[model samples]
Target: MTISESPHEEEPLVASIDVGTTSSRVILFNKLGQEVSKHQIEYSTSASKQKFASGGARRFSVDSAGGGSAGSAGSAGSGAASPSAARQAQQPIFSAEGIAIEANEFLEIEDLERPTNPTLTFPRPGWVECDPVAILAHVVQCFAANLITMDKINGDRVSRSLLPYRVRCVGIANMRETTLVWSKATGKPIVDYGIVWNDTRTTGIVTEKRNSTPQALQDSLRAKTGLPLYSTYFSCSKLRWLLDNEPAVSEAYEQGDLMFGTVDVWLLYHLTANHAFVSDVTNASRTGFMNLDTLDYDDELLKYWNISRDKINLPKIVSSSQYYGDFTVPQCIKPNLTSVAWTLLTDFCSRSPPVPIQGCLGDQSASLVGQMAFKPGAAKCTYGTGCFLLYNTGTKKLISSHGALTTFGYWFPHLENPEHSQPHFALEGSVAVAGAVVQWLRDNLRLIPKAEDIGPLASRVADSGGVVFVPAFSGLFAPYWDASARATIMGMSQHTTASHLARAAVEGVCFQARAILKAMSSDAAGEGQKDRDFLEEVVDETYEKSPLSVLAVDGGMSKSKEVMQIQADILGPCVKVRTSTTSECTALGAAIAAAMAYEKREDRVLWEDLKDVKKWIRYGGVEQGAKSQDGSAPSKSCTYKSQSLDTDRRRKWRLWEAAIDRCKGWMDIVEEGTGAASNSAVKSM
Candidate 1:
C-alpha cells in the first residue's frame, strides 16, 4: 500500500483513519474517494514520540470556564460534541493521590506510545495479547503524521483563510473485536494487554459460558446478538475473560471505575479526549452485546455477560453514518512542521474541534461498502490478516444457520426522516487465519524469502499435489467455529517440495473462502425462498438480494494473482477486485460514509452523483478521480468466470473437512511455544 504523500491539489478532501492489527494508517481522499495523500506507521516501524502524544508537556485544554477558549493551552475544544471540551466534563480532576490528573499522575502517556517491533505478542501458544497503550500511541502518531501532510497541502490556502479545514471530515475503521478495558477515573488500562479479536484466550471462557447457560437462553443470545455464545472471536468473551480472571479488572469493575470498549470505542473515547464514548452499528455488532434487530444493546445479552452498564462505562451504540463526536487533536506529538503550520492547527482546534469524526465502521463492513455492495446479494470478501466474507442482506436480518455471522452492512440513519433511516445488514463468514499462513511459510518455515514470493512460488506448482494445509493455527472460525483445532498439513508425500507447500498454503486460504461461500449460499438461498413474498411487494431495488453472485475481494492476499485465481476457480461466482481498489477499500468505505453523513447534516447532496445511492456508491460522487471505474481505466483484477466441476470441487471440500477433523482439540500443544507478548509491552513502557 503506497501510503505515501501524493502531490497536493486544491480540493476539499475527507480523511480516513484505519487502525489495524499491526499498524495504523491515515489517507486523504477527494470528493471522488481517490487517495490524495497518505501516511502509515506500522507499530514495529516507528519510534516513540511521547512528546506529541501528550500534545507536548502533558498539556490539557482547561475549557472556556477556566478563563480561556477551547483553543487555550490549558483547555481543550468545548463543543457540545466533545465532552472533555467543556469544564464540567472534566470533573474530579484530582488523581487518587490528590495531584491534579492532567497527565503524569495518570497513564505514562509517553511510555504507552512507544513503538515495539512485532507489535502483537503471544501470551501463550494460542493466546494473543497486545499492549493497549502501544496501540493508542501508534495511532496517535499516525494522526500526527497526517496532520503534518494537511499543513503541507493547505499551507498556501491557510494564509488566506482557515474558514474551511481542507480536511473536511474524519472517518475511522478499526479491527472491530479487539477488546480493551480501562479506568474512567484515571483513564489508565486495567489490564496489561488488550485481548485481540483473533486471540484464543477466550476459548475456555466461551466454553464455560456455554456450558453454564441453558440451551434456550443460549439460542436466544445467538438469535438476538447474532454471535454464538461459544465463539471466542467476539469482544464479549474478552470482557468476560477479564472479569472472571483478572483480579485488578474485577476490582475496578465492581468499583464503577471500569470501562470496556472495542478498538473503535477506545479510539473514539481517547481521540475525542473522553468526549465521545460510542460505537457504530458495525463495530457494536461484534461486541456480542448489541441486538441484531434493534441495533441497540440488549439487556438480556448484557445480563448474560454480567456487564453492568451502570458500573462500567459501556460505549453507547450509534449509526455508522452519523456525527458521533468531533476529533480533538492529540497534542501529544509535535510533528516536524513549521511554526505557522502548528499555529494553524492550534487555531483550528481552538475555534472548534479540528474535524468532525462523523463516520465509523468495522474494517470488513467498510470494505463491503467500499466495494459498493449496497444492494442485497452484493458481497465482499477481505483477505487481510484473516479473511472476512460479508453478504449484504438489505434491511432484513437473515440469521445464519451456517457458521456465518449476521451483522450490519452499514447504518445510514435518515437525516430528515429518522424513521426512514434504517440499517443495512450482512451475513459474515470469518477465517481465523489466512495471510498469516503465508507469513508462517515465510518467517517460520523459511520456505519463501518474502511474503510476495509465495504467490510466484505457488504458481510454479500445478496444485497442492494431494496436500491439504489446514491453517487452523488458533482453531477454525466461521462455517467451522472450532477453537480447539490446530494447524495441520495432510497428504504430504516424499514428492512434496517447498513449492508444493507454498501451493498448499495459498490454496488453504482459498479453500476456506470456498467453505464460507458454500455456507453463505445455503443460508442466503433459504432466505431468498422465505423472502420471495417480501420481494414481490418491495419497490426499492436495495431489497432485491439473494446469495452473492459476484464476490468482490480485497486486502494483501487478494494481490496474489495465484491466490485470486484459485479462489475464483473454486467459488461458484466470479472473484473481482480492482487494481487500485484492494488496499484502499476499507479506508475508502469509511470516507464514503463520512461524506454521506456530511451531506445529510448539510441537508444537501455534495454532488449530482451523490443524489442517487447507486451512482454515489459507484463513483463516490461526481468528482472525477484516478479511480474512475469507466472503460478507459485499466484493470489489474483477475476473474475466473467458470467454476470447476462439481465432482472435483466436492473432492477438495471433503479433503478440507477431513483435515479440519484431524486438528481438533490441539490448543494444549500449541500453547507451549508462544511466550507472553504483554511482557515485551511492559518492558517497552
Candidate 2:
C-alpha cells in the first residue's frame, strides 16, 4: 500500500478517538499505518441491573413523604440537573482524610454541570443503550488524554521504540449503527438514552416492513441498500422503533426538528460545534436508509418510513478518506485552572488546520481497509469480542441468502473521473460473541486464573473432548438472530475438566466464525454468484496467491497463541495467522485510515497493494515477530493443515448446532424458574 513520505505529506496531524462499547481509545497515525503515539483508557458501563430497572420503570415519579411541590422539586432536581450533575450526586463525598462519607453529600458548584460518570447501560432485554451526552464527554476526555500522554512520552525511551515518531493528523473511526436523535439548537441528544446495535426493540418495526413490503420490493431494497431485511443492526430498525413507540421522537420528526445519524455523524456534528452534520459513505451504507447503488438515501425508503427528508437532517455522504473538519479543542476540555499565559500557550500549540481527519469509516468497514483485503473474493476474519468476516465483493451487490450481510466496503471520492462515482460493497458476516466467551470464562466463571491463562490451560488438552459450548450469551446473531437464546454448554459429563471447558469455549468461537463463512458461501451460491468450489478457491487463493492469510487476528484474544492455533486447526489447512504479537490491530487500523485520507495516495496502491503489510508473521503459540526484529525475513511461515479429522469436526459441529436447538427451548425453563422465584419473593414481601 502507498505510504506518504515526509516531503509529500501535508502539515498538521490527524487524530482518531474510538469510543467503543466497553472502552475508549485515542490514536495518531501518519500517512503510513505506522502509529505515531497512542493512548487507551477503559470506561465502565452502567451496571446491567440499573439499565433493566430504568427501562422497566419509565414513570418519572419517585414519591416522597411530602407530596405536591416535593414531587415537583424532586423532578426539578433530577430533570434540571445535567448528566454530570446526576453522576456527581451518586459519588460519595469524602472528608480531607477520606475516612468518613458525608451525610448530605453536596456536589461542588463547579462540578454540578459536568457528570462524574457518563456511561451507557442496558436497562432491559432487547434494549442495548447509552447516554448520548455521556458519550460526548468521554470523547473530549479521550482527546485530552491522548495529548497529555504524548506530551509526557515525547522524550521518553518507550515512545521512541513504538513510533517512528511524528504526530500529524487525527481521524475518528467509530461503531456504525449506534444511533441517536439529537437537536441542532441546544447540541443535546434528543433521546435521553442512545440505542445501540444489539437493541432488538425494533423487531416489531422490522417485522411490519417485512410483512407489508412485497418480497420483490424487499429484495430490491436489500440489493440497493447492501443490507438484509432481517438486520436489526442498522439504524432503520432502531429509527422505526423510536418513531413507532416514542411520541416525542415522532413529534420532533413531524416538526422537522429531528437530526438522525450514526455515531460518526453525531460525533462530527458535536466535534465541529454542529457546523457539519455529515458522515462518510461507509457509515451511511449501513443505515439501510442509504441506497447502495446511488450511495445516497433512497426516496422510497424515506417515504416508506414516513420520515420526511426535509425534516431529518442527513449528513453528506463522503469518501472514507477525505478532510471532514478541523479539531478545535472544545472549551469544555480547556484547563481553566491554568494561568492565562499557560492556557494561551496550550491553545495556540494545539490549534492547527483541523488535523485532516482524513479517514473516516465505521469500525468494521475500517477493519476491511486495515486488513487490506481489496480484491473481490479476498476475505479476512477479525477475532475480537465478536468475530466478523468480510469478503471483498468489488463494486457488485451480492444479497445474502445464508445470513451473511451485504455492506459497503469503501467509498472512493469522484475526483475527476465519473467512473469512480459509486461506492464498493462487501459481503459481511458478524458473530456476536467470540472472544467475549473467554472474558466470561475469566471474569464470570473464573475458569482460568487470569484472562491469558485460558490459552495455556486449553493447550493442555489438544481438543475440546466432545464438549460443545454454544456461547449464545445474548442470543445468536448473524445467520441466526435468535433473540431469546442464552449460553449453553452441552455434552458435559463427569469427565469434563476445566481444560476441556476452556478448549470448548475457544472452539465455540471458531465454530461460530466457520458458521458465518459457511453462511456467506451458501448465500453466494444461492444467489448464483458462486458455489462452494468458488468459495474454497477464495480461501485457497487467499492463502496461495494473497500476501497473508493465517487469519490476521488481533484484539486481546489474539495474544493467545493457543487460541490462534485452535482457530487455524478448525478452519483447516493453509491457514496462516498473520499479525503482530501486540493486540494493536484496532489502533493500527485507525492509523492506516488516517494515513490514507491525509496522504491522498493512489487509491489502488493505498488500498490494494501488498506494501502496506509491514509484517505477516505466522501464527505460533510462542511470542515472536513474523519477521526478525532486525527487519529481516522469518525462517519459515507457519501453516495449519487439517489431518484426517473431517469426520470428527463435522460431528462436533453437528453437536454444536444441536446444542443451539436445545438452548432455543430453554426460555420456558428460565421463565418458569424466574416465575417461581418471583412468586416466593412476593409472598415474603
Candidate 3:
C-alpha cells in the first residue's frame, strides 16, 4: 500500500508525545511516517535528598455562594464537586515552603507559575521516586512548547484564509509500570513522589508476600496475572509499599479518595483537563492488576494484593487506538513560553476545536507498533536506558515458562464494539541495563568523555579481551528475575584497558538481549498444538527455520555501530539485525495508532484517497518493499548478518552464562549480612 497525494489539500496532522525515563519528546508525523517537526526536553533523574509535603497538604475551602469565572476556567465547581473538579481542586500551589495550602476554591495566579518538572529523589540507595505533580507539569510543558513551535512552523498553512492545519488528535506513549496514587476529591497525589518503574525499594514487600501467601494461591496469581511474585519490577508491590509506609496514602485509601494509575492514565487525566480517567490496555496490563485473559482488573489479583475495589479508583481500561478524550492546552504552562508564541498558540487553540487523545500505549508496545512488527514471530529490540525486546505472539496470551513477560501488544478499537476490543499479546524480555551501562561508564567510571564516545573508544579494541561485564545495577529483569543480582565484571586482567571495558559493556548488552531471544524462542516452542504449528510456520516463513532470526532495532543506543555489530556477532550467522531507518519509532508508533483511529472514526476524504495504504505501517516499509509516493521502490534497511565463527560464539556465550551464574545470589549475601546485624542488635537489646 502507498500514500496517494490528495488533489484537494493536506489532511490534519497527527501528534505524539513519548514520556521517557530521562527525557520527554513531542513529534508530528504526516500520514506517511515522515517527521514534520519535533521537540524534546531533557530532565535529570538524579534523586534529591530532600523531602517535600504532598500535593494534598494544600487544602482549599470553596464558597459555594460566590459566583466566579473559575467555573469557566475549568475549575471544579462549588458544592459537592464532580470527580474531575475534585481532582482539579487538589492541584498544589507551589511556594517557598514547598507546596502551600490555599483556602480559595480556585487557583491563584501564583499557582500557575510553579514549574511542573520536579527533581527525582533518592532517599536511600536503590530507591527512585519523583513528584507526580512535577511529572504532570513536564507533560504539559512539552505539549505547550512543541505546539507553539509546530504552529510557528506551519502557521501560514493554518491561516483563516486557507484550510486550517488542525491537529486531528494526540497520542501518548509513556514508561510503563511507574505507579502513582492521587486523591479522587482534590486530584492531588497522596505522596510527594511516584514510585518509578525501576525502583527496587519494594523488593522486601514482594519477598514477604511470596513467603506468606499460600503456594496454591501463588500459582493461581501466576495464571491470572501472567507474572511472577518474585520481582518488584511491576506496580503491585510498589503500590503495596506506599500503602504500608505512607500514612497519607493509606489515609486516602481508607477514606475512599485514592485513585491508582500508571503514567499514561495520569497524563490522560490532566491532558483532558481531568475529564478522562482511563488507561489503554497496553499500559494497564503492565501494572500486575489487570488479567491477561479478561483484559480487565482481576478480582482475584486484587484480593491477593489485599487491595479493595471500592477504596481506590482504578482507570477504565480502553483500547489502545480509541478516542480516549479531548485535550485542551492547560493554562498553567502558557507563561513558560515566549509571549509571542504563547499568544499565537492560545489564539490558534481558540480558533480550533480541542483534539482527541486518540491513541495510547506503553513505551515498549508503542515501539513494537512503530517498528511495524505486526506479524506473529516479528520482533523488535528498543535500546533505551534499558533494552526491551518484544516478540509478537499474535492474539494468544501464551504464558512464558522462561521468565519472559506475557504482555498486551495493543488493542485496536473494533468498529462494531470499540470498548471490548480483543488485544494482541507479545512476549517481552526486559534488560535492566542496556544503554545505562554506557552511562555508567561515562558518569561513574569516567571511561568516556561523553556517551557517544563509547562507540569510538570501544572500536579501538579488537574485542573485550576476555573481560565480561554483567550490568545488574538495578538487578536483572526478565528470564532471571533476580533482584539480588549485582553488577559484576569477570575475567579482567592488568592488560584490560578502558577500551576493553567499553567494548565489554557493549557486548554485555548484546549478550543480555541474545539471552532474551533464546528464552522467547524456547517459550514459543513450548506452546500448545495450534500455536506450535503457527510458530513453526512463522519460523519457516520469516527465518528459514532458524529461531532468533530477525530483529528490528531502534532508540539512541542503536546509533552505535559497534553495538549493532556486536549484537549481530553475538547472535551468530542465522540471526539478522535490522536497524530502523528512523530513530523515532516510539513516537511514530503512537502517531500511526492515532492516524488509524482517526481514519476509522472520521472516515475522511483524504483517507479514502489512500484506501490502499497498508492496514498497518510496517517498520522499513518504504525501504524494504513498500511503494513510495513517487512510485519508486525504496531501499531496504541497513542489515547486519552475523560475522562471528559459530564455535567461538558458542564458547563466548557459555563463558557469559557462567559469569551470569556467578553473579546470582550476590544480593542474597548482602541480605544475610543485614539479617545477622539485626539478630546481634536484638541480642544486645
TM accuracy, model 2: 0.76
Candidate 2 residue runs with Cα over 4 Å from true position: 1-14, 30-32, 48-117, 152-166, 211-214, 332-354, 414-422, 523-550, 580-582, 598-631, 634-644, 665-685
What tens-digit string does per-residue lDDT give for candidate 3 at 545-644?
Answer: 3455689999767877877888899888877999885788899878766655643434432222112223323322354455778776553358888888
**Candidate 2 local lDDT, 1-685, one digit each (tens):** 2234543242224467676654455665443444455544333333422332365221111110000111111222222444433443454222111111211111121121123332545566657776666566555544544454444455473445533233554566777788788775666777787788767777667767777898888777777776776656788878878877888788887877788888888777767633567888878888878877777888988887777788877778877766666554455433422233234324634654324455677877767666665555666677666777777766767787777788877765533333333466788878777766766775457676446677899989867788989888777777776656788898888989999999998888888876776675555544432423334334222222332244555555555667777776666554455544334445555555555553344532223222333332121212334545566655232334454276766677778778778877466477789999999999999
Ranking by lDDT: 3, 1, 2
* Candidate numbers sorted by TM-score from highest down: 3, 1, 2
How accurate locally, in lDDT, is each candidate? 0.66, 0.59, 0.70
Better of 1 and 2 by lDDT: 1
lDDT of 1 by residue, 110-219 (tens): 12233332345554666766666656555554454456556555675667774333666778998888989999887778886888787777777788887788898877
Residue 245 Cα positional deviation in candidate 2, in Å, after optimal superposition:
3.5
Question: Where does candidate 3 stray beyond 4 Å?
Answer: 1-10, 46-117, 155-164, 331-353, 415-421, 537-548, 599-636, 677-685
Q: Count of backbone clashes for each model?
A: 19, 21, 5
Q: Give the TM-score of candidate 1.
A: 0.78
**Cα lDDT for residue 407, candidate 3:** 88
Please give the distance, in angstroms, between residue 501's alpha carbon in candidate 3 and its true position after superposition.
Answer: 1.2
